[model samples]
Target chain A: MLSNKKTTNEKEIQKLIEELDNIISKKENILEINLDEKIRKLAELLSSSNSLEEINNCSEAIQRLAVIIFEKTKALKNRSGILYIDPFLMKLAILGSNIEKLSKAFIQSWRPVVGRDVINLFLLKDAMTYWNSITKYSFEAREEKTIENVSKISFLDERGINEEIEEMYNELERRGGKELYDKLIESKNLSEKIFKAVILSFMITYGYVGIIREPLKGKVWVVKKEKTIESKNPESFVIVVK
Target chain B: MEEESTKKLRRAAQLLFFKSHRNPGIKGWELRKALGQDYTKILKKLEEKINELGLTIKIVSDSGELRTLSDPHEVLSNCRFFISINDPLTITDLRTSGWSIDEIAGLTVCIATIISKEGKTTRQELEQILSQKLPKWKATRLLSKYIKAGYLDEKEDYIVLGWRTKSEVDLENIIRYIFS
Candidate 1:
């Protein structure tokens, strides 16, 4: 296990070095060209970040800047989301897009979706099956397999996620008014907050990073991502809560 | 007087044993059903003769399968000895003598086999293969111990037999002498 951990750490270090080189090359490209304001600002922010310590500390800030870059790019070219798209819908789209982008950006910018996201997910699932075998041998829990039991985990399609956001907006309209929506729109860190929340959900629940669980246990409850918010009874937050 | 009966019983018992390993926990009725030629009488005779050998059998409730925890290692060892005086010592017999020579032998065989195939081997590759296939911590811990004990030599990603001066150890020789 220690060897495995060491190997994984080595792999991560190698990947980090490669990614730093790629980002450096991009910075050099930006410097060479007469860059737009957005690219110029991004390049300035990326400068002087070569060491692992700086990279680890500034990565979240870099991602935040990337979100701003994305927004600014959209503003320059009046395409789908930034200018007129519903703010809630915009957040949903970015949430989906950022998960894909961050995963891609971390793995080497070349391989999209890691080319086998679902397969990798399934392999992680198989690791759990091995755990089950170990527990079975130990005579831990002799519970019968619940065959034909429909699970409560209903994964929403992209369309469904978008619709859910739209429905949230509709609920806000019914409960409060355009005033609350405008207030939410005014919050500068809204997108960043949403991204952070989404990432937290991914890390804690989705095994997107890797499921870390106790080695030996009879009954275990895995965390999962949820699309609900419990607090803030005001109009703007109603969409997410419902 | 009943030596012929005992021989028939042993033959039937071996058949039943093989069937159990193939399909564990078979019931008496199912065993009878399986024995098509004079099924009932032959099963009864077999059961009576087996009881005479002082081997008790029972049926498990949940699976309704025949279960027996009789001394299989002893039986196998005795059979091998009867077949030939040079049966050598079984791993269990070695284990009962208060040392785990079998485990060390097994590790030696593994190192030899890997070296033969990969030509050269390393500690990392050995750890990876052992951790992936065998019991993770135990195999790696043992491998490291073997390395420390001069049973294995590491070279990058290749592993080879350490101080043992065997120019060529075939797989059969590995299994028979090293692992046995």
Candidate 2:
């Protein structure tokens, strides 16, 4: 019975070494990631190498880091403050290993409020939007690209609520908003119809005017139409929504 | 990698298409009304996926114009392959298309109504008849209605036997029948 007990303990020690080696493989290249003070103390215990108590302590530290990463992702999405969107996406792309249950658990931890379905929907939509913008990026040289896209797209903390509405009013004055607005407002549900009209009118205008983008920040969807029908559909001509 | 993305999108498309078909013969406008503004973009993405899957979508407009009213009712009728309308494609339609009803419903009485000796009805014909003649009932509801009405008999497939009119049964004693 004593010999059997010794063999079981040896097997458990071997399993602990394998788990630590796997964890280190992922962190090897990430040089700046200093272990937390608590984690450092745990590592001191782990230096003894074969102690079962040290293995348990190291496991606790790994669990803590996972929880921290999960919480940080959730907090970033909720409070929008110029998050490095691309880098954030890169981290997300690396998630989900061969283990299905672990990946699901990780996603569940990261997005507590939004369910998996909602995250999937947003990811798909966002991916399409991102790919569309990236297609526009191929024109410029490499070094100047990052500065142009990322640096320009940053937003200020304070902006007027009516600024968006005023921009529309100004554009209308220059390009006969009266004629378009009058027809749009004629619908019984004026408010609802105006929203549709605004969206339609802008799409028509942009289709004629090539949209400009300012990298990492955000890009406008612009489509430039041919010259023939330009004047006939002036409302359908150059439009900028943002 | 692109092929994988295309496959993912196709799976998503099947979900969207099947879900939209639950309301079979649903128009783009009706889908917009039901699913909100995202329907057009969602469908456009699905169409892109279908194209990636080596399928060509010919946008056959009723009139050659910039904008024409799309009749989903007509589209569903004309489209036969991998296409669906607002109504759920019944077990009967699937059976006629060479799928065993048992595959989907398992061992059950598959009840469907056919118009007086018509072997099988297209979705368009069924919709029109259900809406005009049987205005009170919906097409999906007819599965149960015909079953209870004794107009539809269930076996390996749904067989529509003729319905018994009230007047024909009491033809000999009209006065007594009316009084009773």
| Winning model by lDDT | 1
What is the iRMS for every candidate structure? 28.7, 31.2
Candidate 2 lDDT by residue in tens digits, A23-128? 4556432333444653554455456446565466456656755655555455445335331223333222222112232222222211111001323453556566
Cα lDDT, model 1, residue A10: 46
Docking class of 1: incorrect
| lDDT by residue for model 1 (A132-154), tens | 43323432234432211111122
Q: Which stretches of candidate 1 lie over 4 Å from their true place?
A: A1-242, B1-88, B96-102, B105-109, B165-172, B175-180
List, residue by residue over B1-180, the lDDT tens digit for candidate 2.
678545655644544444232111223444444434444444556666555644422222222111112334445222211222222233334544332322212101111113212233343344443443333344435544333333332322234321111101111121121112
| Residue pairs with backbone atoms closer than 3 Å in model 1 (clashes) | A168-A239, B25-B65, B25-B66, B26-B66, B120-B158, B121-B158, B121-B159, B122-B157, B122-B158, B122-B159
lDDT of 1 at B111: 44
